[model samples]
Target: MSGQLEKIRGLKYIGVVELASQAARILAEIGTTQDRGTVSEMPDERTLRYYLAEGLLSPATEKQGTASVFGYLHLLQLLVVKKLQSEHLPIRKIKELVDGRTERELERLLGLDAKAGAKNEALSYLEKLLTSPSASSPRSQQFNSPAADMMRPVAPAHAARQSAPQQQGQATWARVEIEPGLELHVRGDYAPPTETKGVRRLTRLLLNALEGYRGNMRK
Candidate 1:
């Protein structure tokens, strides 16, 4: 479990401030900052301490003399937690989701790699969020069997509408189609999750909310 974090390759040990800064730089570089004309929520040193205390994050990978040092994976972990929080997920749920997740999994979840900037992979990931619902064929047996009766894309819109506590007063939207011409609107400064699990989680929330709609239309 602790083996993957033992070595960070290039970085020997980074103080808490440096760790947060590096994470911020990565977020900014990935274009999460440019989208809203400001940087997204970044965990500061104090927030990092709180996360570590709550076990939401892994321990620092290494140490330098008397100072504890963090690895690259630590940086990735911070970003992952931040992304999950942006979705309004509770810390307990976020902790559950990220616990024991490997370095590769973390980077993939964030849709980043060493080649991202050159390849514009971040932009590509954004595109995926828009098209993921449409890419999956709606289950033919929807509402037929319990297992198949889940949210199926009927008319996922290009954008959704909802207000947010994250970015107050700024209208945000995440559109998920529940049925044709009927869509779920999540308003806030919303950025669609770039990972599959996050997408599924949101889909389930939308699906549950539409239960009344389904029940009413029962034939």
Candidate 2:
């Protein structure tokens, strides 16, 4: 484990200030700051703290004197989250995907992103989509595409299909009926979850809610 982390620690241990600056620079290279990917702003120290609170980023792995220190793995975690944000992935789901991944896995995800292009390009295109709006990613408004975001596969799902949408490109989309009346509309290009996995998760969540509701009623 120590050796693996050591490999992920390309920038070594760094304080918040340096981490923030370097992360910002990387986000720029990946196009997260673009008009399409569109991250609101570069993350500052305060934002880093927020990420810590939210479980989006890992805790500091080391310390430099009185200061907390983070590693490249942390940076990659942030980048992965930012990339998924472009696909409009929810924070909870993003956490499931980013939280436990290895550095090599995270790097592979970054490399797989259409914007990022390939493995060797590594950091090149990661931040692009993070900054730009989803507009640049051609989509069908409401259809399915190959699971390319394939970076993080959504658990699984199976539900009745409920809509038809125009084609935009290879973008993926989904319509999930959470309950009889409530459903989700996933835009294509979102690297949509397959019906089996997507619906399974949504169904599980609904069941959990219903269980609690029933408990309340019994009271």
TM for every model, in the order presented, reads 0.45, 0.47
Q: Write the per-residue lDDT of candidate 2 for residues 74-172, one digit (tens) a residue.
A: 888887877777778888888777866887778666664344456444444455433333323556311222222233323232111122234344334
Per-residue lDDT of model 1, residues 15-102, tens digit only: 7788888777666655454344332466688988888888777877577876678876777788888877776788887876677678
- In model 2, the runs with Cα more than 4 Å from the true position are 1-9, 36-38, 112-219
How accurate locally, in lDDT, is each candidate? 0.60, 0.61
Best-fitting candidate, measured by TM-score? 2
In angstroms, the error of model 1 at 155 is 47
Count the clashes in each prediction.
5, 36
RMSD of each candidate relative to the true structure:
16.2, 14.9
